[model samples]
Target: MAGQWVEVLGGIMEGSGQILRVSTALNCLLGLLLWVQKIRAGAARHA
Candidate 1:
């Protein structure tokens, strides 16, 4: 019974890791887009 529980726990951990990685990647992409927009706006104002 303990071995079975460990296997289930391992599967959950694997799934959670995949979800975390995907979220982190999306967050980075959004941050880059926002930064680019801000820079462009600043340049337009100066011009």
Candidate 2:
């Protein structure tokens, strides 16, 4: 799935880390992972 992309919008869930983990795994199995607005859970921690 190289060169392919997947977009995941945040703020719909409580854990961005979980989202990242799942998305990363999916990316590995599927394609590229593009996470947008992923600061809804831990904005300051990410900063």
Tens digit of per-residue lDDT, candidate 1, span 1-47: 21121111222323545544554555565442111112122222444
Count the clashes in each prediction.
Answer: 0, 0
Cα lDDT computed for each candidate against the true fold: 0.33, 0.67
lDDT of 2 by residue, 1-47 (tens): 66665567766755777777787788787667565565464555543
Q: Which segments of candidate 2 are over 4 A away from where they belong?
A: 41-47
**Local error of candidate 2 at residue 34 (angstroms):** 2.6
Query: Which numbered prediction scores highest in TM-score against the true structure?
Result: 2
How many residue pairs of model 1 clash at the backbone? 0
Worst 10 residues of 1 by lDDT: 1-10
Candidate 1, residue 2: the lDDT equals 17
In model 1, residue pairs whose N, Cα or C atoms come closer than 3 Å (at least 3 residues apart or on different chains), thus clashing, are: none
